[model samples]
Target: MDQKLTLNGNPITLTGYNINGNNYFMLRDIGRAVGFSVAWNGSTRTVEIDTARPYEEEQPADSVAPTDGSRYVPQVGDTIRCPDGTDYTITDVSRWDKNAFVSGPLGELPQPTCDWSSFPEIELPAAEVRHFQLESGEYLFIRNLYETRRMQYTLQNLAGNHPDTSKDGKLAYGGKGSPAVSIKLSIPSEISAYSFWPWRESEIENLFHSCPPGTYYMEAWDVYKDGVFQRTEYNIRAV
Candidate 1:
């Protein structure tokens, strides 16, 4: 028996055999053809299929909310776009109450007055990274990565010893604390070309802030349907 296989309208070459006038595909070959993981557990006699990628879950704008007890607390300088398409940049934030103050075309207004937070939910634009020069003849990389998982991000010098370790001595996700860390740079959603300080106020608590000059590992995880699917890694140098 002969049949054509297509994935997303694209032809896929699969290693299959015809048995009793029926087509049977090799488990590993089928998994490889579709970018899936095909593994057998001898003890359990079960196979695990990880369909993490190529099937991204789409989330509605209103569904982007901080989970329960999430460490991602909105800080000063975070920008938010309301449902009405009104964009506001947080100019000032109260350290005590954690309220943000915003400025717009009219003028600067209190956090509540802007009504940006009053909306059911707001969105952070795509994360980005930019570099700028200082009076000291030094360049700094400003990470505009947001706390949301809508897009991916990379960073360096933040990987620490964890309780979770794989057979190869690699740090896995599960541990006593969150494997992911929050970035707190004052960088805005959009960086300007001529602005001396393109990024917002520098955050002292961010691990990248005042980090020693060295090479660091950067990683970003992909989220699907509000669940973390997988993570990617990169290397960045801080000078």
Candidate 2:
């Protein structure tokens, strides 16, 4: 289904979970449309979409299709009014966030949109500390941990080889004694963007403060890519 984003002038096509049930989406897919580079600022839990595009008033739901059942599906060339009513183009179609039913071949709306039938839960890996230097002369230290679930997050202090879950479901590598996760600081020269973990509710707020902005959220997926242990990225940013 074509979705109206509140950032750019194009409609975002939908995949994976149909427009019917709840589903997950990517930050970068909508990041460029919003004029911001999605980054992972571990210090704060803030998905910063930096855009020169001034914030416009959100368009009313009035623009939605007439409730003839055709009103709730995804379609090609469909009008995707961003939250602000900006027109954006739907470029492609594929299964987003991994699963699909809602995500199918590109077809215009008036057709039934996809919906997510199932969403599983996941657990975060123990924290692994990683550090970087920012242009601000400050250090952004990230305690990177991974969770392979779909539900909520639990923060914990991973000291040994295994990190436990936090009271709120958040997790982090204990301290220096634990494994220190490293990140390649240089920006990606290709489509392979790096990811780090950050939570607004996490205890490490100072590390998230040293970012260059445009940070996004931590994404979670299956452990193996195509059936391997390829580490996936997060979908969050430092606040």
Alpha-carbon TM-score of each model against the true structure: 0.21, 0.20
lDDT of 2 at 126: 39
Candidate 2 ranges beyond 4 A from true positions: 1-75, 89-91, 94-163, 166-234, 237-239
lDDT tens digits, residue span 19-60, model 1: 898889876676666776665542353666777743222232
Q: Estimate candidate 1's alpha-carbon lDDT, on a 0 to 1 scale.
A: 0.32
Clashes of 2: 62
CA lDDT scores, all candidates in order: 0.32, 0.30
lDDT of 2 at 89: 28
Candidate 1 pairs with clashing backbones = 155-218, 186-200
- Report the C-alpha lDDT of model 2 over 21-55, residue by residue, as the tens digit: 86656565655445456554323535555575533
True lDDT of residue 100, candidate 1? 36
